[model samples]
Target: MQTVCRDAPGCPEPGPGYPDLGAVPLVALNVSVRRRLGLYLNPRAAVAADWAALAEALGYEYLEIRALEAQPDPSARLLDDWQGRGGATVGRLLELLRDLGRHDILAELRGRIEEDCKKYLQRQEQPVQVPAVDSSVVRTLEMSGITTRDDPYGNVPELFDAFICYCQKDLHFVQDMIKELEQTTFKLKLCVFDRDVLPGSCVWSITSELIERRCRKMVVVISDDYLQSNECDFQTKFALSLSPGARQKRLIPVKCKAMKNEFPSILRFITICDYTNPCTQKWFWIRLAKALLVP
Candidate 1:
């Protein structure tokens, strides 16, 4: 039986002259066919160099070499040199790539990319064993591989440039808000406790840093319990520690629970944002976003 195939634009088709006994199954040939996938190098020369060992380790096979550089021949020679070196360097490079690849994508995209990378690696005859990953490794990989210049979230800047200062009592609430905010294109680098505190940092230092410099805005989750806690007091006080010349107002008092009296002395200057009213909460995020000046 003769099989008709879709030919490329302006490309001639193999006709009756083409030798085909039709004895072989088409699926068998298609099964081993390599896929054209994207592999980006930080310096870009990695592809042109045909660093197969490096490519193999990174689970890449072919490089769609770019035309910007004039000496493609020399680049090929470099790849030949690297390949013949027994690929110790390539192995190391692959290890680094595997460790670093996890962090470059958003939550949704990360898993798919990882699976694809593994499959590609397997096809290249250098199947990489999965390694146990920790948050630090993930963070390192993410920061290293991210293609965007400085912005962590690609084109979308965070919704709140300011730091979010809230008590542990409202962790769930803050987390929920963060989840909701992420669903939108409006991003916020909201600093909640537990999540933002670097593992090695001293507790008080982390507190001080988040309040003092890291955050562009301060959001105090107000409730009687939060006001009573020493930890909360220190955090709030540090947030209020900003000098007069700071670009945005230092405090945004979010009334998480209704109170008969006003907020404490330090928070009294800023207008209260009541979370009770949906409109107020919406307005609070809007104003907080505005204060952040996120583009």
Candidate 2:
């Protein structure tokens, strides 16, 4: 239910004095945030004095430790200190990273962090419906280490960036596609049949999983040869079925070669990449990469 307000035709107040209602906050450190940030900062370290300065300001006596084994990451130690400092938030850390000129790592992290924050705020605005449960059941669930914080899809991680759908005749193009998309700086993980599929696995079962769950997008290589192959036909249709009306834009059609047969009627609405174009070759990979990146 939505309550339209006088602020705008379709707008409404989120709550009383909405913007200041803590709907969006500069998130403080938690175990998950620490673990994520630790990974990003692990490979990039500030000077010892810089870290020491930040630590000292945050009430830590020293950033050093005496140990027989390799020390815990300085980044992790800093995050722990930040947590203990009573809500030293991510915004403060971003300012430090920016000042240190770690822009190489800062660009992606800052973009993703901002996006995640926006999502968090949006989620906070939505009404939550908590079902009634017995106190004993709630305790049992807690004892079993289950909570509302658990990710629904955490167990089933998508292993491939995109699934390459092509016929054997188009394998050479797929090889080239891999060279351009995966081998270069893009470093995309593509699920190609010959390269990624297990030798003894059930083909139909595995292919279904790859299309439906494992991969984020399905790159369909279209050509006269590709149209002739039954497997390519099946895979294309299956991918389309999963995202009817192309709602997710998960099915990406690439015209690797001139096609004598008509384009699939089902995919007519989709804007495809035409490799046949000589002028747009330079921008093709970048455009495709951007498409794959869109969440």
Candidate 3:
């Protein structure tokens, strides 16, 4: 939060007239929004030593995580703590939330905070410089199925660094994947089904097109939930079909956790990255990012 000024789509702070968003108080946010934010951070309880995704996303050090997750308002405490350390702002919080792939929450937080700022400015008779809602945020939420879709794919080609296929059960892990690959130095664009795919399209058709034409590589998150998903089966097999014998190095199977069942026989020919193994953890993101680099 005190690190960068990287503002994101959705979060509008320093208001139409207010400047210096780098230190907006948490009190500027609505109570309901603060409570909603706790829904994501409190229960996660990421301690400093774990190198947990939440900790990474928020850039928290030491066991300071518990101090941020304090009750009544964990999100508020987190923001206050970051601000107290200097350089905390609404824009920085938005950027961190984006890294966590919680743009849905970002949109809500942004709107409420803006509304509060607007009211305060109006009472002061301050000139309001209300810019239009960020179109990119709108378009993003639309494509992610959080808002109305006005032909999401028509304006842009679907080409991407990789398409991530995972069960909802593994969304947190996938979010971590996003934080590392898309947010960090890798800067890889990941087409997550839930976040990037347009809603209401025929799932099978869209999935097939993305696997075959849109993405350069396929990342299949393998776990019990994924194994039970019929849709994952189709996407997995379809990717394999396009790159038979693993000739293209196109399909990257990431085994994140232990499971009762054996790894799928078909994927046996290809080597899998074991994320649960401590030895490989150091090189996991590096290996995955390298595999995703376009040939």
Q: Identify the leading candidate in terms of lDDT.
A: 3
Tens digits of per-residue lDDT for model 2 on 101-174? Answer: 44544554544554554544442342233567445444333222121222233442436789999989889999
Instruction: Give the Å error, residue 63, model 1.
Output: 79
* Per-candidate clashes, comma-separated: 9, 0, 0
Whichever of 1 and 2 has more lDDT, that candidate is 2
Model 1, 1-295: lDDT tens digits are 4221212222124364432213221111111111111123323443342333334544443452232123333223333233334332322332343344422211233233333333323322321334674544544333322222224432332223555666777777677667755455666666656654435434565455445545566777787667556666656644543433222566677777666643554444467667777766767666555655543
Winner of 2 and 3 under lDDT? 3
lDDT of 2: 0.59
Which residue pairs in model 1 clash with each other? 103-142, 158-187, 159-187, 159-188, 162-216, 162-217, 163-215, 163-216, 163-217
Off by over 4 Å in 3: 1-155
The clash tally of candidate 1 reads 9
TM-score for candidate 1, residues paired by index: 0.41
TM values, all candidates: 0.41, 0.47, 0.49
lDDT of 2 at 257: 86
Q: TM-score winner between 1 and 3, please give it.
A: 3
In candidate 2 the C-alpha lDDT for residue 200 amounts to 48
